[model samples]
Target: MRFQNLMFLAGASALALSNVANASDLTAAEAVQEARRAAAERTAATEGQEIVVTATRSAQPLADAPATMSVVTGTELRRRPVQDLAEALENEPGIVINGIGMTRRGISIRGMSNEHLLTLIDGRRINDALANMAHADFDLGWVPSVAIERIEVVRGPLSALYGSEALAGVVNVITRRPSERLEASGLGLLGLRDGKGGDTGQLSALIGGSITPSLGVVAWGEYRHRRRTQSPLSPRESELEAREALSGSIIGWWEPAQGHRIEIGQAAIDDDRARDTVTTGARPVYYEYQDHITRAQTHGSYTGSVGWGELQARAYRSVLERVNERDQNQTPTQPTKATDTVFDGRLTVNVFAGNRLTVGGEHRHETLRDSTVNTAGKADVNHNALFVQDEWALRDGVSLTLGSRFDHHPAYGWQTSPRAYLVVEPIEGLKLRGGVGKAFKAPSLKQLSLGYITVAAGGRFIITGNPDLEPETNTAYELGGTYYGRSWNLGATLFQNDLDGLVQTNCVEFCGVRGRERRAYVNVDEARVRGIEVSGQVTPLPALSLSASYTYVEPRDRSKDRELAERPNHSANVKLAWQVADATEFNVRGRYTGKQTIYQADVPVRLDDYNLWSVDVSHDLTRQLTLKLGVDNLFKKRLAESSALYSFAEPGRVFFAGMGANF
Candidate 1:
């Protein structure tokens, strides 16, 4: 750790303690008690209440939730200039951003792979067909920033309720719902980089209101564009890809009875991206590739009261299409499409005085069409699942939850996932929680189709899919606790995941043949990830607040007996916010990532540690208008200038400005 970083952390801690001690004439414990009382009363007035639903499929306060969870509200979203879901969540505890390509980033939770992370919108699954594709990052930007109400994040496996794909954790983006009163809003933003190229622009708008006594609707649209960035060392070489995207959604709800409601919605995103690069060789080659991608979905949901309990049902169809063309070879364009059709229903009932039981079932049909991989030009799979959960309020401030899910797949037969969680609140403002869960991830359609084959490394290698491959599985354990004071909160958690049956491509034929390598996807890897996360937030003054979090992890490949590649050993984040006046606010944040090890052609190489800092300021110009300005990468960090171990680009200093209006 750097000396300045250590000093910054220590100063923040000291300031928090000193403020509490000097804020009142009473002792430290007494002052905290008084603050708690004040906070409770303030919460009663509708300011400090945080209701989350992703953990148990039911509404509950953050303090009473049965899992390690975090929330990012609409207010926070508006304060930051976040481009997509990955940026919106990169600061949360136990979360990390990983670079995949020149302009693509992935989210990792506690060193887990991105493929195991499940994403949801309004508690419904989004399309994840691109998760296994090369340089694919289409699933992270479905919901526009202007339409999100809140995002609920669970930091551990929830397969017991969500089934496959929830092996690592879940991130649910909840969009704004229809309102009884009419409302409209819009925002415009522009950004410029310090050096050549790398510029950005965005525009978004939304409107919502009641159309009739019992019907309400909401609609929104967004358009964004980013210019390509060029390498500093080589003017003709590109560092970042240029992209243009447009997305929108419309949702409507109607109530025909006192407690019954029906909602229907449609959403779509169109993205066009291009990359340019200069390849150094005996004869220099200049190449460019363009990717056109589209994603669309339509869904309907019903929620109502039944004699025995409450019933909720929903159905949706999602599709993704991608077409790619290269300018150099003048090759024919390649197009691929994936579709998912699903039906799900769940019922919650009061099984006894203190126990609530939930039962649900789901069916999903998936299809993939790719002429290059599937000999028939298409492949399909079906999945069915049943789940049950019981939430028992054992006593005051104590709860226990038990859940299990059973899924049946044609290729894998039947797989079972189960979980048990306990939350104990020995005092009024503290909670201790623990859980043990089992989870699994089924093979992707492309990986499970026996006839699937593709050429790699310029036709030097042949990779084929195996239908006999087994599903990857995991067993996870976690224990955590949180303490909430009048003006501050603190939390810590310890977690471990045991993973088995991991899939990897292995040589199956012509292993020693120089240009005729052949490999098949197989399950023959095991690993484990263990870590600790500590976070805290303190509001020493009504106009100022400080928050910090730190994480340390050890990820090991059991089979190889070595540390996993691209997994950081330590990371941390810190933020300071100040309200200078009634209409003005300022924020400063910093992030630190420790060194990592990566394998290059069988040799382990270590990368250097780095830090990033940013500053943002916002002011309300009027009751209906606001202005925002910020500087990112304040120290001008760049991958090419800092180290040569990595090939991806790290953005340099950027200046951005925006305006928003509500009417």
Candidate 2:
């Protein structure tokens, strides 16, 4: 059947070629040139030099970066045939994805909790002002993968640059920029599943072109529709799920004079009537959510040679408003809303002596409002920070980086984070890197203003709050190396983090009346996490590629001799890709997650290990058209992606197919 379909596509292409020959004045040679030019442009857009991510808040080569970082281009993301940021990062080493009904969840890196990491879009922070201090989920439901140009994942401590809440790392998403030429493109998918469901869809669009040499604009949008049934044991029982989102952006660059440039851009996303199952009985309960967000930013930078070095200055402001409403049985009792504003500025100079110096400061203020029957909470937070870093080349192929940041919060007084790194390259294609750093996370407003009544022993109710909670702190060290050659790339790293003053809730049964319990925030004496990660990719044949990654982690509470909750001991992923022909390709992927213990109320619960497999195939029907088919969780693994404390389940086996076109 596949071969027959291929034949039909070939015959249709031939017919289209004949028509073009009969109707166009261009010769075969001219047509071939035009195709080559178009291919060249696509290649430039899809596969160019590795993007220098500002993950450190400083632009640097991903490979040359002293810290561990991974780059996933828009082209690479499409190859995997998955939508959503968490899905895209699942295969990356040292990263774990948690799914909450497909739309809400978090990601853990290097054994750290999801809330430990910070997420940013185009250098602007995405703030979640909830009481728990957790960063909001990536909201993949509204993020259009088609508009993503690339994603950068920087592992390890980054508090020196990003301030509080960056104790784990940073994930920066870069959006697509307009091209100089006029162009249009689209894509779609269709497929079926064995265990749960199937789906079919298409995405078509146009983009690129400059109104004038100084001003450029690009606009693209996607419309996708899929039908699938919820898993039998899912929080929501069997029900059809529908997801639709529309997104578009405009970017303008102005080079008003020499050595200076100004950029302004705005993006808007709207998701309508997203449905999900929330189990209330044998039959699945349904809920609908309407989410919308709009973001706008303007930045200006000036660069020029001054004296014996290059000087650069940059300043920008960004605003984000996220509103979500829930409808359960046509009754909207609770509505949540949040707004964030940030102002940032930085300056740097590169000296002729090969020393790079940087200094910057940022101020962020946030306000959150929530209304629920019996519960109403409002809070505001202000954070101000200043940092400076110096990169010194002590000798040939050897360099050292030293940095420190001072942060002041309205609730927490002065705090300092410091870092040091050394890099030595004794030979080509090999680098030795080591670093030590201190990072911290301030108490979230939810932790400060939390005034909710909870049932204690004997059904007694009690309220709790910790206005004196201190910020959590961590000290970490890492050693790593990277080796790259013509046909293979490999990297390995060993890291350790020591946590102090870890904020956790403790239950004191005797303190409450009627033998009830009172929960309050207290610092954990000590905790530690050590891990090693290895990743590599090898292309032995022109049409075949092999890639693999593995991570081993040991996380423990030093005071109790117990493993941390939801910290996997071992994880691995293997993937194989083959180009069947000029216009066709196939991929197979598998992942394994080892067992881990979940700790609650000082008790431990064990979870079993599990594995999952997936397959994807794509075909290019024409210069401007493509098709993709994929099945995720081929075996419908019923493993838990998160601790049972969250009451969320991983998605079961499902199928997806889509197509795309360009003009």
TM-score of each: 0.91, 0.82
Per-residue C-alpha lDDT of model 2 across residues 1-663, encoded as one tens digit per residue: 232353344446545644543464444454455445433433332221254555455566555675777776665566544545777778777887653333355677888877777777776676443233222453443345666778888889888878787788888888777656666654444444454543424343547766666656666665544444564546464333444455555666665555455566555554443455453334544666444444444444445444544445555544444555566664332344555666666666775487888788877776655442125566667888899888888888788888999999988777899999888878876778899999999876656665633332224434355677888898989998877665567879999989888877676445534435577666765889999999887766556677788999999888777887878899998887776665667889888878777656558888777788999887665545556678888887654443344333445676765555545
- Model 1 spans > 4 angstroms off: 1-48, 278-284, 306-308, 330-333, 458-460, 511-515
lDDT of 1 by residue, 284-357 (tens): 66788788999999999999986667899999999999998777774534588988999999999987788999
Clash count for candidate 1 is 1
Top model number, lDDT: 1
Q: After superposition, how far is residue 89 of candidate 2 from its true place, in Å?
A: 0.6
Error of 1 at 335 (Å): 1.1
lDDT values of the candidates? 0.81, 0.64
